[model samples]
Target: MSGAQRETTEYAVPAGVLGLKGPVEKPAPGTLPLRGDLAHIALAGSHLAAHYVIPHVRTVGTEGAGLRLAPRADGEIFATLPAGSRFELLDVAGEWVWGCPGPQGPTGWCRASDLASAES
Candidate 1:
């Protein structure tokens, strides 16, 4: 290989962050295996992460609210779902709603404020 280093043009969202840890969800019988980096975010040349369509979205919030493993403010931070992040509605009680990244996502509870919706 020739010694050549060229920096790629930067986009709104870095391409490296678009990949997944594993498959978004499991494949059915006889289904083809999926590649690791399937999830793509739009950049300026493309677009930004528009949405995260979950099962049922009631209300969408911002990072100021913060995502947590539990509904409480002091709960463990599972993942940082930035503004407009889609979440699947699982369970809701009072002011807290349980959710996941998607249908087959690891379930957790986020503060009602952090969620798009706290309703069932």
Candidate 2:
């Protein structure tokens, strides 16, 4: 404790509250005390303006994964993932990404955090 300033972020009920449809994140890294059967997703560490989609990656059968255009609803459309588009997962909150494959390939970016420990 040498006078080093530290900042902290808080996770709201939407993040911790169970029965939520979105992905559930952990309070601390490597800790999974609370969780359900929510699909994990990968994010670009920091919010990206135009996250390009990698070719050959599957999506909603469109073509081109762009940045989050407008404000989205809680369970509304977050972003548009193109078909045959693949996006890299930056600092994921988990280890395993999970979700159903879209008409193209994978639906969207999901955290593989917990899926890594699954036996299958």
Candidate 3:
């Protein structure tokens, strides 16, 4: 077989933090899988995180608020940021929404400019 046929695609981290432990969820509607780096922001009263989407963990933002962050792997709640939490936008869709990873095993949709890095 040709090298192309034998070769497989290496699933890069979906635009977010790293070393996080969670489950992987289905991408949003009309959205496709992204490679490396996502985007997020912090709530009105919350703290930010270092990385974006964690590897193998799922995240989900709150409902209606347009915020979600799920882990890529399945496990206990390794970490949490609670509502009004802070996050960085590793990926942005248009100028409205951002796809980010949250605490262990929790991925969902979120606002575009609602998250911020802990450094910021």
Best candidate, TM-score: 1
Candidate 1 accuracy as lDDT: 0.47
In the range 27-56, model 3's lDDT, one tens digit per residue, is 443233233343222210122244334233
Worst-scoring 10-residue span by lDDT in model 2: 30-39
Q: Report per-prediction Cα RMSD to one decimal.
A: 13.3, 15.6, 14.6
Candidate 1 residue lDDT tens string, 1-120: 466653443123443465444434444311221112221222122222334221454445755234555467787765565677666554567888665555444456666767654544
Model 2 stretches with alpha carbons more than 4 Å out:
1-74, 95-120
Q: Between candidates 2 and 3, which one is better according to lDDT?
A: 3
Model 2 lDDT per residue over 1-120, tens place: 777654432211233233435443443321211123321232223112233222222233333433221212222333444445444332233432323332222333343321223233
On a 0 to 100 scale, what is the lDDT of residue 61 in model 1? 75
Q: Against the true structure, what is each candidate's TM-score?
A: 0.43, 0.20, 0.27
**Candidate 2 local lDDT, residue 108:** 36
Q: Number of backbone collisions per candidate, in order?
A: 5, 17, 67
Candidate 1: count of backbone clashes, pairs at least 3 residues apart or interchain = 5
